[model samples]
Target chain A: SQQGEEDPQALSIQEGENATMNCSYKTSINNLQWYRQNSGRGLVHLILIRSNEREKHSGRLRVTLDTSKKSSSLLITASRAADTASYFCATDETGGAQKLVFGQGTRLTINP
Target chain B: NAGVTQTPKFRVLKTGQSMTLLCAQDMNHEYMYWYRQDPGMGLRLIHYSVGEGTTAKGEVPDGYNVSRLKKQNFLLGLESAAPSQTSVYFCASRRPGTGRFYNEQFFGPGTRLTVL
Candidate 1:
């Protein structure tokens, strides 16, 4: 079963605009991670936010976590054409073997 | 160091055939995982290992088996291939964390498998 569900199954934005993707999960999580995958390639770990952390930033990426609502969001500041990719959210469920359950993902397209 | 690598980037097998996918990581990670990605399904865990000589089933373990004889290698096998098993398989490895949280996982390029 899928632990997380991403909103806006697909998003298209201009290159200079900011792109935000949201993910909501069902159960409590030890941490939440965001990954980016280019077409026909493996995923790359972008950022991770622990349950105790409300927000985190890495380069052009910012991740926010809200354990109370079981939701998280990823913000790509000043999106670039190179940033076009599929983004997925994964959750490490509490009490489990630390296995990650992923969301369906949001396909983001940055138009130049 | 090569973080993680998978063998046979692409493969095609007829129904009822068997094959094994190999995953090797040079980071000496303690945890290894296998996942399959399909359209609209994202990535689903197939099997995982905590250490050498240890293996455990994941969400979709049916028709699949795994082995971890060496700390740096994890193998996923298919006893009998089915069309439903056609998907892109990815292998990931991560070092164990000190506390409850786990470190980030490094993923391989992935293997594209097509079952007819």
Candidate 2:
């Protein structure tokens, strides 16, 4: 069974706009991670927010975690055409041997 | 240095044929994993290894086999290719720290496999 689910399966936005993606999970997690994947390519780790932390930021990326709601959101500011890719949220359970459970992902398209 | 690399960016196999996919990581990660991605489905883990010479089954491990004979290498094999196995395969590696939240998996360029 999938542990994480993302809302708005697809999104299209213009350049310089801000894009937000949401993910909701079932169980308590140690951390939530966001990754980006270009068409037919590998995934690049974007940001990681620990369970103890409510929010984190890295460059133009911001991640927020709400353990009470079992949800996380990723915000990319000033999006560009290069940002067109699929974004995924992965969760690691709260224990040893952190096995990742990934969400279905949100496909974002940035129109230049 | 190459982070994580998978060989044969694309492959085509016929029914009943067998093949193996190779994944190598230069980061000297202690953990490795194999996953398959079908359309609409996120990713399903096939097998994983915590260390060299050890392997464990993941969520969807019925038709796949894995080996981690070397510290920097992991292998995923298909005994008999089936059309249903056609999908994108990704290999990931990580050096998880002993902390509450340290799972960061680095993925390799996926292999697009097609079985007929």
Candidate 3:
């Protein structure tokens, strides 16, 4: 079974607006990482937040994690047309095969 | 530096045909993994390697086999291709136990395979 499940399978917003995506997992994880994939391309790492950390920031990207709920959220401020892509959340489960399980992803469209 | 690279960017195969996908990394990561991406299915792990000569099955490993003969490369092989096996394949490599940041994997561009 997939360990991570992302909410809001698809979303669309104005270029200057903010976008939020949520991810929920079933098991305890060491960390949760966010990635972006433009159409027909490989995934690009965005930001990662560990279980021990509550929040992290990278430029316009903010990530928050709540272990009690086993969930995480990624927020993008001032979204741009170039931000149009599929966003995914991945979890590194505890004591597993050193692999990360990815969510189905949220397709975000930033209209210019 | 080329973080990670996968060979044969695009391929088309007939049922029962055999082929191999190669993933190479220059960062000397000890842990390597192979995954397949299908529409609405996200990315599902096929196989992974913790180190050279070590291979392990993942969630969807039924039609695939993997080998890591060297620390820099991980190979995913399909002895007999099937139509159901067509998907975009990705390879990732990671270094474990890094302080402050962990489980940060480098991914290859991916291989688009179609089995007719």
Candidate 4:
């Protein structure tokens, strides 16, 4: 069973736009992580928001967590062609041996 | 440092064939995992190892086996390939941390497998 589900299966936006992807999870998690995967490549961790924290920022990436709602969102500001990729949300259930359950992911395409 | 590396970037197998996928990490991480990705579905864990000589089944553990004989290496074996098993496989590693959310997995270039 998928613990996390990302909304907007796919999105296309113009360059310089801000892209936001949302993820909802079922169980309580220690943390929620966002990862990016380029075509035919591996996933790269982008940012993580802890259960206790409401939001975090890293460079152009912003992550927000609302544990009460069991949801998280990733905001990438000023999107560019290089930002085109599949974004996934992963959650690690508390006391679950650190195993991460990943979401289906939202494929984002930035048009030049 | 070649954080994580997987062998046989791509492979083709026939039904009932047997093969092994190798994953190695240089970060001296204590945890390693194997995941498979299908068309619309996201990556599903097949198996994982928390330490040397320790392996555990994950969400989608059927049709696969894993070994973590060395701290730096993990192996995934397919005793008999099936058509449905064709997918992209990924290996990830992370070091143990004091806090549960302190560690983030580092992934290797995936292996694309096709079972005809």
**Highest-DockQ candidate:** 2
Higher-lDDT candidate among 1 and 2? 1
Tens digits of per-residue lDDT for model 1 on A1-112? 9999999899999999999999999998889999999999999999989989999999999999999999999999999999999999999988878588999999999999
Quote model 1's TM-score.
0.98
Candidate 4 local lDDT, residue B2: 91
The 10-residue segment with the lowest total lDDT in model 2 chain B: B96-105
**Cα lDDT tens digits for candidate 2, B1-116:** 89999998999999999999999999999999998998778887889998999999888998899999999999999999999999999999999664564868999999999999
- Evaluated on the second chain alone, the candidates' TM-scores are 0.97, 0.96, 0.95, 0.96
Candidate 1 is graded, for docking, as medium
> By lDDT, who's the top model here?
1
Q: How far does residue B82 in candidate 1 sit from its true spot (Å)?
A: 0.7
By DockQ, the better pick of 1 and 4 is 1
Q: lDDT by residue for model 3 over A50-78, one digit each (tens)?
A: 88999999999999999999999999999
lDDT of 4 at B23: 100
Q: What is the lDDT of residue B32 in candidate 3?
A: 91
Of 2 and 3, the candidate ahead on DockQ is 2
lDDT of 1 by residue, B22-101 (tens): 99999989999999999999999999999999999999999999999999999999999999999999999999972346
User: On TM-score, who's better, 2 or 4?
Assistant: 4
- Descending-DockQ candidate ranking: 2, 1, 4, 3
RMSD after CA superposition, every candidate: 0.9, 1.1, 1.4, 0.9
Which residue pairs overlap in candidate 3's backbone? none
